[model samples]
Target: MPVRSPSLVELNAFLAVARAGSFRQAAQELHVTQAAVSRAVLRLEQELGQAVLARSAGGVSLTPAGTQLRQLVEKPVAALQAAAVRMRKTPERLRLRLSVVTSLGALWLMPRLEAFHLLHPEVEIEFRQYHHDEDFTRDDIDLWIAIKRSAPQRWPRHIAAQYLIGREVVAVCTHERARTAQTAPLLLAQPLLYHSNFPDNWALWAQAQGAKLPLQRKGAGFDLVMNLIEAARSGMGVAIVQQCLAEADLASGRLVIPVPGSASTGRGYFLCRRRAQDAHPAAELFAQWLMQQAGAPPTV
Candidate 1:
């Protein structure tokens, strides 16, 4: 009997297909074709003389052998990619990658980021608008600004998070609607706009006011806060949106907070990072600048 040496190219192809569980997706990642991906996997499995995957109606699944190989490959593949990225970096300038929810990205961070850039001309800021579900730590994101429960134990040990702002839900509507609502249907009777993450927001606000919320009475639902605010601004409905998101509109007299109440949802915007010690120099500087901005007296 003769031993056969494994092919790294075929092994990589096999791993990609296994991880993605689809030949086409793996091919896309490798910049090859589905046929090529299949051929590579077949070659790898033939050389090993073992069935690495099981064919199924739904898709492909790794056999015990394939599972072991995938486990072995994932770490090295990730490490290689990380190494390649690190090798290319010359560190001439400080760069920070920030992951922020869309609304906060528009409402708060963007408006103030210019000042930070002006102060630290050498530091470059990179912003990626993200949704709520994505994990900032896993993506190698430098910093994450989100509304998260303030539970230290629930998060990973490598990540450090802090409460940045006290959450406030304000009843906001277009200025015209606010002026008209002072006499017509009560604030509670106004059409409700809902954000996916805060469906019970109106109810919570009502509860804070010692009244049963009528949130279930049918209304428009928006997946994004910006859309919801735009709907309110268009006089389509009234929304109980976050005060921070509504600040500019409120100040510009485009929107008005006719109701006077704040509900503590036990949630607030938090800054999360994977151990501040390893943070990018630009990220650290931005964090410090944000803290100073937060602590400074409200000029507006």
Candidate 2:
């Protein structure tokens, strides 16, 4: 007889634990009891005939087998779940497909989505996150909340755009680093942190302010905004990033803006869609809700 594969539930539980690195945290994330999560992992281990995870006081670490399995299954599992959801939705349900760059999606949108879900329980929203760029050609997406330059004249004529918020770049570092307001001299004294996708951010901000920042750069660049933020919080260096993405930390006193005046780098966020596609009702509702949340005018 062929070997029986682990069930999806078991794989999901295992993946969740691997992600969280603790059964308790994974259980909380999955909205299940800790005992249930433990049982699922146990069942998976029994099926595999070996230990996949190493448990200890420091928390769980994946074994060699677990690491291999996680690499193979993570994307496939998420895709399977997404496909299943599409198949399971009823005709009566209103669904909206939306895309956005990863930084804005994680830092800004995800935290505020609960309110939208509360207000419009009947509308189902699907979020597709892109790491580097916005993809407007995907036929299934109803709308895209994208980060783009403020110049509407440059936008594709075939796309309809709504203004959201301008991107204000701020230089942030720990209190230990910046005893006073940020200046070009003070900023250049420390490492200049940047995001890989927007490598020109520091240059843009400097030019916007006419600060004459160095043409050649030094310091680290992170592909993910979260990593850059954490690096700033850890006092790795002064990081230039969008203000909206770092507001939570600034409010909590985890990070402080050293820049005397945040500079707009001639870019902003816009809600966009292809001109040819008919808008979904759910997309309309989401767009309205998002505009209100963003305090932006409804039209471009």
Candidate 3:
């Protein structure tokens, strides 16, 4: 059976006016006068045998019939826009989307990412530096490198997790403080600083060492771990920092590791993603390259 239809132009005009809730606004969008938009709506209403809009003090509103029609059109319109965008995008290049904590992004991943790119020149890697948290499903992240003290509660479907790196806390201080703290009580007495995220890290380490001192009363705390390390390096106070983050300072003789014993925090860096068994071509290549670079175990 043949179906009769209203003009696409008139339907589009009706949609614009309905969305904007004003003839003037619709006219601006359609590049026509307000009277032209009014005419188009009236023509559409006549063809559909229904009133699509109601004029009121608030300017305009969709009638019940218009609301239903608008709902039907909205998704298709959005889909068409999306399709057009995808079609316009060049297919020759592959885009890899990744997200990671700022600390890791700066200290660890950024330096190493170039190697991955060198291997996969055709793949255009896009990195999103995430500060707090990430929604694996909603955020268009292909690879997620998260640094944390504990593992996540859940993982998305097709996502696989692997331990990327391990770092342990060490007492770091300037050369002068290192020279001064040669004994036990002095170790506990030095205004020990803390990282905000690990508020009780100093206390936990002290307790682990069986050195019962006034750890809580000791010092100031900084939010960023790097800032805490910088403070320690400048001789502000001794800080328990991850070895990986402090290795450069320690090696340069600017900061010294005061305590040899380490408190097992069971915290480390991890790589997680949606597809467990499968990996994007670029991701797979990078993963293999990373394991080689880090000397990760065969199982990892």
Q: In candidate 3, what residue range of length 10 has the lowest lDDT sum? A: 291-300
- Root-mean-square deviation of each candidate, in angstroms? 15.3, 17.8, 17.6
After superposing candidate 2, which stretches have Cα over 4 Å from the reference?
1-92, 129-135, 149-153, 180-182, 215-217, 296-300
Whole-model lDDT, candidate 2? 0.77
* Predicted structure with the largest lDDT when compared to the true one: 2
**Which residue pairs in model 2 clash with each other?**
none
TM-score preference between candidates 1 and 3, better one:
1
lDDT head-to-head 2 vs 3, winner: 2
Tens digits of per-residue lDDT, candidate 3, 1-300, equal 765777767777888787557887677656678899899889989989989899888689999999998878755654453344335557345677778777656655666677766655666878876746665554577777766555345544444556676545667788788777655457878888887887767766777777766735677799887788888977887887766666566767788777677665666676776542232555544554664555532120
After superposing candidate 3 on the true structure, give the runs of residues whose Cα lies further than 4 Å from its correct spot.
Answer: 1-94, 149-158, 276-279, 296-300
**Model 1: C-alpha RMSD to truth?**
15.3
Each prediction's Cα lDDT score? 0.72, 0.77, 0.69
Instruction: Give each model's clash number.
Output: 0, 0, 7
Better by lDDT, candidate 3 or 1: 1
